[model samples]
Target: MQKSVRLKSFELVAGDIRDVDVELLHALSISVRWPHRPKDWELFRRAGHGIVAVDGIGRVFGSAMWFPQGDNFATVGLVITTPRAQAQGGGRWLMDQILEQCGNRNLALNATHAAYPLYVSLGFTSEAIVYMRQGEVQQTLPALPTLGGELNELPSDRLTEITALDERAVGTNRARLLALLAKDASIATLSRGGEVVGYSMRREFGRGFVIGPIVAQNAWDAVHLTAVHLKNLEGRFTRVDTRERDGVFAEFLQRSGLGVAETVTTMSKGRRFLNREDKNPWVYGLAGHALN
Candidate 1:
């Protein structure tokens, strides 16, 4: 039997991401060691538009997706290129297609180390560093700050109640994306004087549940908001993506056993995506790397 054979290179073409099989997309992500399950891929497909690089035989080699939030902003994610294609500039080609499709909308993305230079060269400037924290939840959570307001679980149908608060933190109206996430998420809101002040959502993804989109007025508030979900998730695998590099909130996460697993740079192509203010609602946790 022949030990090896070199195959000739072939032409590739752009194809609609929706037209590809979910299993193929799953395989593509796995090739790059991404943690997206097929369900996650389906959720992404439903939330945005994307394109895939394919060959004559319909094999997918790469993919790039963009989720539009309102008319002026979008987040790019799920950019992947098979090992065999990366050397040939497949990643850049896929991103070019996404940029063209995005039109005039501002863009943001969480860039892995390998892709950082590519995004920078394409005009994306760094904004912040997101720590990808994950681990088995500690059996006993660290002592939380004194409860300052009512922390209540909100029915997903009442999603509208928190859209304004969400926008205040995210800097854009992502009600549509939040509605889709609500379909499978458990939401909690912190209210003071009958006014919602902070919120968090927990949903299944990748290797476990992710607690995110946590919006709050301070690190203490962020701690309580996240603790509400952690209390119920003890001993389960969980992840939280946040730009809180250091502070009470970051300390809480670290002490709770959700150590930093990796870090990604948040890059933007147009208007600034993050505008944080002291004592104002800010995103303590992100919705997702791609959705940010």
Candidate 2:
């Protein structure tokens, strides 16, 4: 059931995200200087479910969303509150509602520096630092093939293989989300001996085209996949959000024309963290911090 709390001047009622207006969510994100478009909110609505806090006037004041990786894990994101609603406990309230819906499943979220302490108070611990890179693609780069693998466009027949690799790399079965992304994005894959080993997805995003969730066998393959994806995006705006641990790939992105934009802490409050294994870590880039 939805919850409600009373403030000094207005009543804050929690309800389903479907009940909240997408324009209001977009406005709330923009009020905080987030670079999300209405389409982004639509995408979130399709891939996950969320809760919204509405004021007495039926205006949305805060929101929170969670994408279930599977039965055992989920990722929470799109947590935002209007400036006027901050410190009134709306943010915390929305978080509590999301947690309630998640039950006892492990949960993960990326937190901004300002919001870091708040999540910590709720039992989330910082795990990794993620960096954002964005800029116009000024140069046309050559396709660098991965060793033992050839770079090519992702074939529709390889969806199963891609989803399997993604589940292993991201700890989630996002086949639905991946299918939607693949339909609208230019996908590049690295194949070895008729098997797809790595892949990258690039498509129009906040500012321009964003390439990510670049799952590859190693840094070399990751960079190669990235190059292949970028070759077609030359002279266009592009962005990539990558983990700090991908030191080599991060540096490569910098040299490729994208500049560091911001960094956020990846935090989790659960029994497990995504991509915790070191063996052939294929998640070189994330789909987005929100989805990761």
Candidate 3:
């Protein structure tokens, strides 16, 4: 018998991401040094639809997911391709499938440095820079401004209280996504003059906990909202994704020991995806990179 026979080249095909085993998806992500865990994959699956690139033997080589926000907007993410397959046009193929599935809906995504050129070539416009911050929470948090409102715990059942505010900040009605997040997240809201002004959620993610979807009107409010969760997360690994480059909110995260771990570019196609105005609610912290 011949030993060590060379195998013939295999063709890649698109498959439903949900059909693959979670472990395979986990391995595919691990191959790229991504921090996503199996649980993260499950959450993303529940939140959106995706496709995986696989060969005849069922080995996954790449994946792409798009989350619909309302009827006309969507966010594309989890676009990954094995290093060995990147130069073989696997990434672009996966994206073409995603774009086709997303239809004519305006699309948005956060692109890593390696993936930036591909997205640009696909006609995505630069929008903003997102700072990926993570580290052990400080035992002592930095000084925060005087609480201008009442900070109170929000039961997951009362998710409606924040949906409108969240929609205002993200420009979409992500009630379904927020409801899914609230199922496992410890939620807090700031109230002033008998009105809910801001909110934040702390939940278990990749390595530890992530505090995010933090919606507020100003940096001071954002600081107070974040501190409410950091106080309890002292000395534990925590991550926060935000587009804030400077100001009180960004400074607060640095002071709390969550330094910038990496950066990703926020890009959009079709219509503008990010728009900020003074004295209006804004996304101080993102729910997740994929969810954005």
Per-residue accuracy of model 2 over 1-292 as CA lDDT, tens digit each: 5479765466888888887778998898898998888888888888889988887788887889998877788889989888876877777888888898999989888898777878999999888888888887758553443466787887655678688888778877788878767767888888889978889988778768889879987778888888876777788888888885446677678777888888888889877575556664567788887788
What's the distance in Å from true for residue 183, model 3? 0.9
Weakest 10 consecutive residues of candidate 2 by summed lDDT: 140-149
Best-first order by lDDT: 3, 1, 2
**Lowest summed-lDDT stretch of 10 residues in model 1?**
1-10
Cα displacement (Å) at residue 121, model 1 = 0.9
Q: List model 3 lDDT by residue over 122-168, tens digit each.
A: 99999999999999999999988999999999999999999999998
Candidate 1, which segments miss by more than 4 Å at Cα? 1-8
Ranking by TM-score: 3, 1, 2
Q: What are the lDDT figures for the candidates, one per model?
A: 0.91, 0.81, 0.92
Write out the backbone clash pairs for model 1.
Answer: none
Clashes of each: 0, 0, 0
Model 1: number of backbone collisions? 0
lDDT of 1: 0.91
Q: What C-alpha RMSD separates each model from the true structure?
A: 4.5, 2.1, 4.3
Off by over 4 Å in 2: 6-8, 140-148, 155-157, 276-278
Better of 1 and 2 by lDDT: 1
